[model samples]
Target chain A: MKARVTVTLKTGILDPQGKAIEGALKSLGVAGIASVRQGKVFDIELAGADPAQAEAALKDAADKLLANTVIENYNIEVRS
Target chain B: MKARVTVTLKTGILDPQGKAIEGALKSLGVAGIASVRQGKVFDIELAGADPAQAEAALKDAADKLLANTVIENYNIEVRS
Candidate 1:
């Protein structure tokens, strides 16, 4: 199985890096940009486990390497 | 309007940071024993623009700052 994890900053957090990127975009003659926030994604390959088992494993992965829950939120999707 | 941009390492790109995170996770005893890949996301708020216009702006953002297209790919989602 394969799992895709998306990690995003929590609302209300100050995203300086994202803002910097937005600014850079505007300077590059890329108009219409209003704002920007940032996040992460993880694509993992599992050991051909069942969906439930995969979910459990993925949760473990999230708690460990995928996210810092204090500042970020993560969502996981599993595919065969 | 708001736009979400997810930037991920292209397949076949070596992700040392992701590997390091995986190792850290394992040492933390949070084991699923899987591989890890890392990516980035950007959430943007527009100036009350339509989805189509927002998408154009987002593309510019991605091209300029949100992603290093040499190794990263981005997807944009617009929400009102």
Candidate 2:
């Protein structure tokens, strides 16, 4: 199974990277960009085939290592 | 309007960060782990409400600044 974990900044968190990207976009002549927030995505391929187990393990990984819970939130999607 | 851009390393690209994360997960006792790949996600807000325009602008942004076309691929999703 494969699990995709998307880790994103919480609302109201300061994202300097996002700000920089927004500025870069504007300078590159890509118009109408209002705001930008950056995040991380983890694509994990597990040895196991069970969807439920993969989801649980991915959630554990997210909580333990993939995300900073105080400032970031993560969503997990499993594919078999 | 909102646009999401997910930037991922192309196949056969070396990802040290993903390896490090996989090691970390193993050390943290998450079982059945195999391989991991990391990517970037950008959540963009557009000033315009038009979905078509937002998608186009986001694609432009991704090509110009958000992604390295040689070693990365990006997918853009627009929401109004």
Number of the top DockQ candidate: 2
Report the lDDT tens digits of candidate 2 across residue range A5-46: 999999999999999988888889899999999999999999
Docking class for model 2 is: high
User: Please, what are the lDDT tens digits per residue for candidate 1 over residues A22-54?
Assistant: 778777888777777778788887775798888
Consecutive 10-residue window with the lowest summed lDDT within model 2 chain A: A50-59
Interface DockQ of each model: 0.68, 0.93
Score every model by TM-score: 0.87, 0.97
Question: Which one is best on TM-score?
Answer: 2
Per-model lDDT: 0.81, 0.93
TM-score (0 to 1) for chain A, all models?
0.94, 0.96
Give model 2's TM-score versus the native structure: 0.97
Docking class of 1: medium
